[model samples]
Target: MSAYGFEIVQTLIVDTEPDEYVKRAMSKINAAESNYLAGLVVGLRDSVLAFSMNVPGTTSKDFLGMVLVTQYFVTMKEIGALSESNPVFITHGPGTVKDIASQIRDGLLQVNTTQN
Candidate 1:
């Protein structure tokens, strides 16, 4: 992966909080559309992150970060959102976005720094 020079990481912040989280997710979705349309109008970049997800009602804060941590069904339903090369993490118990994000961050803290 390091050979790529610069990596394009896509992250999704999963949570179901007061309406604020939902609004932020929607904003990211719209940003994706905008980026896609811009690429079409202009031209695609050599290295692209292309962040995307199936929000159904939930999903990321950073461009190069975790994809999402929604309910199992929602995550499965958006399987297409992930690249074939990317990894998927599943949590069995209940947790908010922060809880799950923190767990993942701590687990991978040595590997990389998490950006929300």
Candidate 2:
């Protein structure tokens, strides 16, 4: 089996991923970055959406987290490359990655057995 299952060549969902996350994702792919980040998850409330043009760079699509839309400051270790076992950041939602077990522990259906 190959270690890298996440073929970057796959189609990407733009709207679902935030602009910031996209930047980070691209950065991760661009250079060797950390794998895990434990950042503060700030809640998105009824606040006026602001934009800053100084934050240079084209729209990115390499984000990798989803605990909350505002959490991106506490990154433990930046992963070097994408692996087949790496957590796949869901295209939808704020920015949550699927659990390992939940990701691969699927496709199995068992029939209920009756015990006498």
The most accurate candidate by lDDT is 1
Question: Which RMSD does model 2 reach against the true structure?
Answer: 22.2
Give me candidate 2's TM-score against the actual structure: 0.13
Candidate 2 per-residue lDDT over residues 1-116, each given as its tens digit: 24666546655675765689789888987554333221112222212112223334423221212222233222312332435456745344323334422332242222223321
> Each candidate's lDDT (Cα)?
0.58, 0.36
Candidate 2 at 115: error in angstroms?
A: 45
Candidate 1: list runs displaced more than 4 Å: 1-48, 52-61, 64-66, 70-95, 110-116
Cα displacement (angstroms), candidate 2, residue 14, comes to 52
- Candidate 1, residues 27-103, lDDT tens digits: the string is 99999999999986564332222334433322235522344354444766577476674666655454555576676
Assess candidate 1 and give its lDDT.
0.58
**Candidate 2 wrongly placed segments (more than 4 Å):** 1-52, 60-116
Provide TM-scores for the models: 0.24, 0.13
